[model samples]
Target: MRRDDPIPLVVDLDGTLLRSDLLLESALAYTRAQPLRLLAPLAWLAGGKAHLKQRLAQAAEIDVTTLPYDQRVLDLIGRERAAGRRIVLATASHQLYAERIAAHLQLFDEVLATENGVNLSAERKRDRLLQQYGQRGYDYAGNSNDDLPVWAAARHAYVVSAGGRLQRRAAALGNVAAVMAPVAPLQQLRTMLRAMRVHQWVKNVLIFLPLLAAHAANQPTRVLAGVLAFICFSLCASSVYLLNDLLDLPDDRRHKSKRKRPFAAGQLSLGIGMALAPLLLLAAFGLALWLLPWRFSAVLLAYYAITLGYSLYLKRLMALDAITLAALYTLRLIAGAAAFAVPLTFWLLAFSMFIFLSLALVKRYAELREARRRGETAQASGRGYFPGDLEMISSLGAASGYLSVLVLALYTQDRATVALYSRPQLIWLACPLLLFWVTRTWMLTHRGQMHDDPVVFALKDRASLLVGLLFALIFWGAS
Candidate 1:
């Protein structure tokens, strides 16, 4: 009963009242204030939008309270409420942040943010608003061009100062109105990069594991197909990651370290993810279809569906969680075989599963270990594995590595073996090195020193690095 129009006042936080420009300002201030080691990465991220929204969300949560909110704007909210209107604070910022801002204003009856845990970005904000207010008629106020879609989506549009390019283009639209916020290009760029999360693309390299061991060494066509497969897979994976992050933004903001993720941090917006996700998917499958045809296109589609399920339902399950993750990795190998039209052997299938299962278990152990060490409440996402249980997982990981070695050795000697290893004699050298690598890696993992990702760790750890080199050299020299 605070807003004058009882028509339901839909007010956006970032641009309409709290100067939206403050986000970029905060980002710049943060970069300059921090040590170069930290600031440099953020600034570099700014050059691209890979992690922009996340960084901004984080900055907002950390510094929004400290920054001086406009007294006039605060007074307007207070006075507007006193006028007996149905006031509401609408924003694409994290719900936590939005709620805090709403509470501080105390003029609104209800606050509409992203999912209570999900960071509300532009599109999400629009979606929620529409779900409540309807698409044909509702007054919408926002700061950036990203807000235009949502505004144009409304019955009437109120543009804040930060809406430069968007306002110019949308001014002619019947419902558009105008307001003020500062605008800076470089600062926005920095925020955008942090939101995109480019570093995560490295995970896509897993798609190449099958090629590393298979017989594609001499064939350029197969090699090219493999690369294309990984690239498409990476794009799809990242798209799903973005969707997952968008969906989990709320919980992530609650978590200690995960809060630093782009969406949770406020640098990215839900609208951006919604807008970008389809484009990314199209590109992923477009390449999948162009390079590999229907068979592979189906695998890529399946990967997407499986991962989307993981994001929504499977990830929270305990043991099943790791199994799904391991299967997903195995699928990458399967996809590679299909892409190259190469024959897959029993050893390759079994080896990939066993290795990934152990690796997934190790990831669970690391997560649980972190939780236990911190004395925090942690639940296994759906993997049937617990954060506090590492001993069994460690043993299992060790067994998996050794078993992989055993399988590969037997595969070399198996009557059905098509490889030229000659009675498992040459392949035997790979055994101890694998044992050394797996054991050492697990030893470090148990000690709580191994990085969260085993694949990434293999790239960095000196011993595993050496093991990988030895495996490649031995395999090639024998050939």
Candidate 2:
């Protein structure tokens, strides 16, 4: 080829052509599909990263259509292709996934990727391109420091989604053709907050339930303990939530709203998320052990254990998953009672179990309902329910909800109710209001208007908020 001929454009797949890492993507997919065999991926890694990538690619294929591609990179590739410049897809990702992406985009004239025993990344990638294109015969597009070597060998470097430091480094190579705009710090902060799910910390407020139920508002020490418990629980819960998101990447990518989640949307790096999860958990446990009672710390450990189990295996069990979710919610209440040394009565436990169970089923029912609307006939992703199970789920959920109301009614008739309230009869009014709210919740879920998480829905719903205020008012008046 003549030196005057336009240099070939070679694009890196992970973090370059695509906004996400395919190796991490495949690993997450494999784990989600076969969580019980998690060691399988690790075992492959023991051989080499190339073996790990190849094994995961063969074990669980990612949906190329759902991958978050950098639109700017695609546009650049398109413009280059239209100019009759050859475009190549080169990467450290396994050949299996790379081929699928190349075929999906249909823009790459050639594909160079890791195969056999070789992990074609960094220097390996540079060597391969050098051998194929000769020195300065190709332009490369990449992101991250890993691409620094490849950029040095290329005639012109193109950076994608890179920060200022990376741009400066590439410029020192003295051949940067273009630099795509980076994500803003504020936007990145928002994405990180979303990934950590700070909003969901509201659920940790359940640690205060015993404080309210015991009418211990006048006791500062108990109240302070509850606040600390809430913070500890929030930190631990966020840790679990991040791990769940990491493991559920493939399923989340296929989900309607979940696809926008940080990990699934490529807004957060998998490595950073993986590191952050355990650090957060450690911080939580450190706080719990240092500040809370021993029993509270033990209860927090149980919560973590159960949540890990649910994320690992229990979530796949039919009917059992919802029951376990209810149990988890009940555990929060129990933990609260433990935190403040409050008595956890049978009435409170009974009411919590039934109500949380109902909400759990509501979550499942909503997922199945969405699957039906999406024309899916198979079981919902990472769930045991099929769309056809909607009717039964609704029936069972409504029954559990009503059972909670029955528990509340029975509690009002108890001698303890008389001891705690000036007019125990007024406590009976809460039963009907709860009935209305629970029934309305199920109705909205049935009509496909509810969020996937019922708790989140309740937090945002105006009607639910009003009912909560009224319930608080009634209880305070009785006290």
Candidate 3:
């Protein structure tokens, strides 16, 4: 074949023209849409990969426009198309998704993808290309070891990889035309850590609430148990974060700020998240079972189950979502009490529920306000909330927060307060500070200045920190 001949440029879809795998994307989407039918994918896969892809494609609705496409690959294809080279989109993904992506890009002259019964990949892809273009009649761009066969048959190969390992292997075929640079591994690692949401572990500090409330911080063994409980809960929380991110991939991609998240942006692989979630959960349970009391383990297990439920279903229910979030936060305190074998007072539980419920509502309010800012008049995606419900939410959330303060005020006057604190009246001062913080939080949320997570916001907010310090001093003085 002459070098000047009109050789077509064929691009692989997953990890080539796009930064994500369609199979994994569709599978996750399917899981999110029909969580109850999660085991159905395994059954479909029993038939074959193509069959699995086909079933997922039919069940899951993927928005191709929002998918993470490789800009470099798009630019390359654009250049080739302008130069009158035929551009083909060849992917192992389902034909449904392949066609949709091709239609969205509008740069492919034809699409060759998995259809009917055959998965158009590896040897089959190579054979198909050979049958269409003869030897050395086309150029190819691909990623992954699965594309090695296609690369060997192409007149020119374009490698898309984060590192040179794949480039070195592709170059061995003696046809490498170019290499597309990918994000550095270190940067990708940081993004993956962000996906794990290590910062949100601050919420696990609630596990110390029981210790603090019981005035047992001076007890060395109790402190150690609290620390261990925090670690176990943090691990379990991170595990839930991973699974939630996986399930919320589609919804996250639609959100303005969340779109940049590692999983949503395709910076991290779904398979990694899937594998790490269960492993982290196991580690959390193992540590709890070995070191903590059986009651603590039970509480941790309950936390995981409820959180999993919230991620899968409860989160889509309007008021119930906030209630579930509050319950999760309260469970952290319960876990702490269980860890230390401390008696959980009714006052503490009531205060925790009301306060955390308010915070949960703040989270939802912020999301709705953000959606309104984007000029969306429809219901919040993947949530059972509409922008119009903002006022009612604010009303209910503020009232709930104030009720917590009322609980605090009443607790200060209780007979138990006299038994616990020498200067019980000093505890009364905390109620106004609690009220002030709650009011300010709602104000910021109403103004769309609050983070999605109120606990995380409190960790970073100067006002919230100052309030926390004052509240702690008041309690210490009372004790």
Q: Whose lDDT is greatest here?
A: 3
Instruction: Write down the lDDT that model 2 would get.
Output: 0.90
lDDT for every model?
0.67, 0.90, 0.90
Off by over 4 Å in 2: 1-6, 40-43
Q: What does each candidate score in C-alpha RMSD? A: 12.8, 2.1, 1.6
lDDT of 1 by residue, 1-479 (tens): 32346456577777466643334433533433342344554564654442454455555334444333545456655655677756678765555566666676567778876542444656877787788878754666666667767777786676665546666766766776545444366765565555555555676665565566564667887778878887888778778777776655445655556777655555454456667777888999998988775777888888889987777667777667778888888888778777877677788889888888888877777877877787765564323555557777778777877887787777767755445543346667888887777787788888989654787777767777788788878777665
Clashes per candidate, residues 3 or more apart or on different chains:
59, 0, 0
Worst 10 residues of 1 by lDDT: 28-37
How does residue 166 of candidate 1 score in lDDT? Answer: 67
The runs of at least 3 residues in candidate 1 whose Cα sits more than 4 Å from the true structure, single-residue gaps closed, are: 1-11, 14-163, 166-214, 377-386, 416-419, 422-424
Candidate 3 per-residue lDDT over residues 80-195, each given as its tens digit: 88877889998899899999998888999999999998999999999999999988888999998889999999999999963678778888899999988778889878887898
In candidate 2, residue 185 scores what lDDT?
89
Q: How close is candidate 2 to the true structure, as a TM-score?
A: 0.95
Query: Which pairs in model 2 have colliding backbones?
Result: none
Residue 215 CA displacement from its true place in model 1, Å: 2.9
